[model samples]
Target chain A: MNTTSKTCLLLEDYLDGQLSKPDKDSFTAHLAECDACREQVRVSEKVRELFNQHPQTGLSDDADLRVRMALRREQYGKEPAKDVMNLEETAAWLGVTPGALAERLDEIPAFEIGGRIRFSRKRLEKWIEMKDGDILLQLQQSHLRKDNNLLQFPGGKHGKQQSGNSGAV
Target chain B: MTFSDEELMVMFAAGTMAAFDMLYERYRHRLFRFARSCLISVSAAEDAVQDVFMRVIRSATQYRPGYSFKSWVFQIAANCIRDIGRVERKMICRNSHNDTSGLEIDDRSFHVRRIVAANELDQYLKVLEPDERMLLILREYEGLKTETLADITGTSPGNIRVRLHRIRQKLAAGRSAVDREGEI
Candidate 1:
């Protein structure tokens, strides 16, 4: 490679102080001769300096503590804080096959500790409650759909009953 | 005696809380800052940092000592930040004046100018795509070696070198523009 083109390749390493003695020597020699390269080196150095100069940003003290606590909770699993059921126990309690429950382990709110997955009774109950809510919503939507269908077919028994009630009124 | 990060990772893999704590103490600040730079919000950064450590905890047994712990940990953090960015879809810049007051100064740059320039730097960073921003932050701010960056980014070191050159050029242009404005 030509000396100038080669020197350009060394700029990154030179700026990072990663160049070896021989390479550094040659790079500096070229820098002394080439003002453009010299200016580029100066600007690159200044740029790195500017970035390095900015203040060290870190999480706040409380944030650090919170993160540590959260990690500890994750590693230990949430079972220790309350009554918990192991995978088999939870599976039996839910009346599902162990293999089937294992398939839905992610869908269930469970924690893994010591390579064993455990389910928190409280959280599982809450999750079940949420699931029940979802079921209720689906039932309501299905009922609404049925009612709309019956309303559309006014000759149906339900629609005739409604029409008779309206005529009597 | 202080354990190497990889050694700590091994101990942590064996469920040693002390080792995990040591790792946390060593990396909490740097990782938080790394996340903050990427997510651009203190709260989001906080969440991302916590998620990163949680991932480490979850995957402790799966970590192989063959790799650099630093790169592995940062790769996890970068993934966490990207996940949060995708889910949140809102990148918030720190209120430079309010948030910058407590950072430990590394150089004697004029404080006001540094703040303004740093804010401008954030804006430019936000303009780039998330992956580019992560690449720049990891290389420039975190001072990760090119090899380590390549390891974390899953790219060749040669590719990292080329990309870093372009990133530095952008940073240099932004710095010059901000400096000129300060003079004006």
Candidate 2:
């Protein structure tokens, strides 16, 4: 079968019984004739099962609190007095639309709990600085590049000067 | 009930300690796991996590709102682990090839099974490079998305996916070999 067909068959939809009737039929037909596809299905299923069996490891309660306390003291230079702004609130504080902020969610590191995104305040703050630093770095690089180009050609005025000097000499 | 991650970060920058605590509570375990997986030592992992938080604390004042806090923290953790691993390898060059053995297996349901399985898998993992092992663990154990995995590892998602596929194939082949020997 074609790459597209193979991809469709390999997708979660095909495995999860979410595929449309015709698509499912096509995938099964292909699987019936293809030993490789059949093996892939088995492997995928095993992988899923193994992952499910692998329990999620978590931090100790005290360690969790310690980490937070450390971060608080480190970032703000003081003990935490209250909960900070959340994802939505941060987006609002940045003066951008929520969609715009959400678009860059991947750029921000986060953990999802029941569909809600949780962020590290310390990390987020650093990220914001790094982003601004990146912008500044880019602007500097662009300006440097422009200056280098000008130095290389000195362009119209320099060209005119060189020609005039050559003529006078 | 509590402020969200973004809110905490904003509050953190604005000088609230509570927000910092919330963020720490959220990610400390994952970061510790990521660190321990790489360094293979509890002490080293703890140190790495501490360093990561320190960096975050020092850098919080520079935070921008739109960026992903998860990606940023993972990136820092990855870097911290990488640096620590490098130092560790250099300090104990003779022990560089030692296998990873300290992964805490506490699931009582499959205590024996997990022990045996982890032993078998640990051997195979030892054969791979540190970066490769990290890639596999992040993808398999952490269940991070390809994009987020890429962001953490500093590779393109396409590259991460291809690497993961190759690693999975290798692991499967190894398992098959073990099965043939009736070891697992």
- Best candidate, DockQ: 1
User: What's model 1's overall lDDT?
Assistant: 0.67
Per-residue lDDT of model 2, residues B80-136, tens digit only: 888998988776543432333444555655655654554444555655678777776
Off by over 4 Å in 1: A1-4, A32-43, A78-169, B87-117, B123-127, B172-184
Q: Stretches of candidate 2 above 4 Å error? A: A1-57, A60-73, A76-169, B90-114, B180-184
**Per-prediction backbone clash count:** 0, 20
Candidate 1 on B119-181: residue-level lDDT in tens? 655655544667877887776677788889999989998888778766655655676677798
Best by TM-score: 1
Candidate 1's displacement at residue B136, Å, is 2.3
Chain B TM-scores of the candidates: 0.78, 0.78
> What would the per-residue lDDT of candidate 2 be over residues A13-98, giving only the tens digit for each residue?
46546678888888888888665456556655665565455443555443433443344334434434223444434433333323
